[model samples]
Target: MYRTILLPTDGNPPARAALDRAIELAQTYDATLRVVSVVNLGDAGILSPETVPVDGVRQSLRGRAEQIVGDAVERAREAGVRAESEVVVGVPHVEILDAAEDADLVVMGTHGRSGLKRALIGSVTERVVRRCDAPVLTVRAEE
Candidate 1:
C-alpha cells in the first residue's frame, strides 16, 4: 500500500538496518525510497568563538551527510529498489518530519537508549515518532 518510503540515515548501524528494511519494503510494495541524511547544525551553536571556522565545519558536515545519503541510495538501487536521496542541514527531527509530509511511510532506526541515558541524550527517533503524521516503522540496532 506504500507509494513512497522515507529512509533517514546517519551511516550508523541502526541506520543501516533501517536501509535494508526500507529497501525490502520498497521492493515489496513497488515504492520509491527517499533517503535523507541530515547535518545537525546544533553543534555549531554550542561551540565557543575560539573554535575553527564555522563554514569549514558546516561544509564538512554537509559532505558527510551527502556521502551517507548517496551510499544509502546506492545500496537501495543495487538491491533493485528505486531510490532518490538528499542532504539537509537542520534539526534532525524537524527535517525528517518535513520530509515525511510527502511520504507514505517512514522507516528509521532507533538507538534504543532508555532511562537516565535516554533522558540525558534525547532521541531524534522518539521525537519524530511523537510528531510524525505518516506511519513510522523503527528498526533497532543490534547490540
Candidate 2:
C-alpha cells in the first residue's frame, strides 16, 4: 500500500545494492520512487589558516550529488517506475529522515561496519534507522 518510496544513496556499493532493491520494490508495488542524495557541508567550527577554498569544495560536492541523484532517477525510469530525484544540502541521515516524511517507506543500504570502526566513522544508515519514523528496509552490501 505504498504510494511513495524514498531511496537515499551515497553512490557507494551498499547504496547501489539498496537502489536495486528499491527499484524492485517500486516496480512491484507500482509506487513512485524518490531518489535523494545529501551533500553534507560540515558544521560551522573550522577556522582554517590554510586557505582552503570553501566555495569550490561545496560546488564540487553539489555537482557530485546532482549526478548521483540524476543517474539513480534515470535507472528508476528505465526500470519502468515513476521517479524523481533531489539533491539536498545537510547531514545525510537528517536529510533522509526529512525526505522520508512524505514517503510511505525508506529503502537504504548499510555499510556493514561494526565495533570501533562504526563508532569512529559514524553510520548514517544507522542514525536513520534510529530516528526515522517510516518503515526502513536496509540492504547490506555484498562482501
Span of 10 residues, lowest total lDDT, candidate 1 = 43-52
* lDDT of all predictions: 0.92, 0.90
Global Cα RMSD, each model: 1.2, 1.9
Model 2 segments more than 4 A misplaced: 43-50
Question: What are the per-residue Cα lDDT tens digits for candidate 2 across 1-143?
Answer: 89899999989989899999999999999999999999886731134345777777778888988999899999999999999999888878889999999999999999888999999999999999899999999999899
Residue 93, candidate 1: Cα error in Å is 0.6
Q: Which digits, one per residue and each the tens of the lDDT, describe model 1 over residues 1-143?
A: 99999998899999999998999999999999999988888754436485668887788888888889988888889989999999888899999999999999999999899999999999999999999999999999888
